[model samples]
Target: MDAKQYDTLQQSLSPKPSIIKNCLKAFLVGGIICTIGQLITFFYMAYFNFTERTAGNPTVATMIFLAMLFTGFGLYKKLAQFAGAGSAVPVTGFGNAVISSAIEHKSEGYVLGVGGNIFKLAGSVIVFGVVSAFVVALVKLLLVTVGVTNW
Candidate 1:
């Protein structure tokens, strides 16, 4: 190949600052998400008579709900504007994906409506994650039964 052609190919394959930037963004956003959950945990424990451990799980669930709610209300778009892939690379993104699809398709009417399209983008990730977990479990089971693995 010509040097120019090789350079172009290399540029296409090489990692860019944007990818690293997005990843760091995802990390920061994800971290901020966890931090919010932590604050909720503390709030519940201190003000609502809940124990620390009991508060945490529910706080996370609430965060997911709020994220979904925000997306439903068209608020997540603004956050995504600020956070970039930070907002796009978390469970909040999944919520936005599902809810936004639902709203976008809501005019299609009942069966063909929100229910049918709500999961559009996020569904693939959900399916992949579940399938991967099942595969990992099966592999572990096989390894155990075959006596070739030790944890």
Candidate 2:
């Protein structure tokens, strides 16, 4: 068969995706995840006496820890399958990525496998965050020096 014929056959065989349904699913799942995070923050503020500003750090830590635990137990995979990018666009996804990578490499040995490969997926994220923060700080510094903003 010719290339054009193969392409036609492939397109005919592929199932059409339901964009609206997928979007609704993603929106609901993502919203639920964020709501859970907000509740955790509120819990910290109410029970632990943390201020709104101070509650952010612990809230994020708790979310990441919970995500890692869920990933370890294989629950995050099912959620990811259902929610798609909804499950991946949050900090919890970072935890899942790190733990999943470590788990995948565990068979090769501890130091060489887990340690070396643990950050294989997450390292880029860390680098991007660091670089983005530095760039933002530089821009703010320049703005302050030029009297366009205040410290």
Candidate 3:
């Protein structure tokens, strides 16, 4: 067959993706994760004597830890498959990416496999986070110097 016919045949055989359903899944899952994070933050503030401002650190740490645990148990991957990008746009998604890489490379031994490869997928995330934080701090410094607001 000619190239155009082959292409048409392939297109006909392929299943169509459901854009609306995928979007709804992503939205629901992402919102659920955010809600869970907020609950953790509130729990820290209400029960752990952490103020609203101070509660974010532990709440984020807790979320990352939980995501790592879920990844380790092979649960996060299933959720990711079902929820699509919804499960991958949050901080917990970062955790899943890191741990999943480490787990994937664990067969090559500890130092070379887990340690070296742990950052393969996550290095960009770390770099972006650090760079963004620096940029924000610089902007805040500029604002403070110009008396835009009190420090």
Question: Which candidate ranks first by lDDT, i.e. highest?
Answer: 3
> Sorted on lDDT, highest at the top, how do the candidates line up?
3, 2, 1
lDDT head-to-head 2 vs 3, winner: 3
Weakest 10 consecutive residues of candidate 2 by summed lDDT: 81-90
Model 2 per-residue lDDT tens digits across residues 129-150: 9999999999999999999999
The candidate, 2 or 3, that scores higher on TM-score is 2
Clash list (residue pairs), candidate 2: none
TM-score of 2: 0.87
TM-score of each predicted structure versus truth: 0.72, 0.87, 0.80
By TM-score, highest first, what's the ranking?
2, 3, 1
Q: Candidate 1 on 28-144: residue-level lDDT in tens?
A: 877887677788788888888789778866776677798878987788998787678778776677778887888889899857888888777788998999999999999999998
Q: Which stretches of candidate 3 lie over 4 Å from their true place?
A: 1-9, 131-151
| Model 3 agreement with the true structure over 94-126: per-residue lDDT tens digits | 899999999999999999999999989879989
lDDT of each: 0.81, 0.93, 0.94
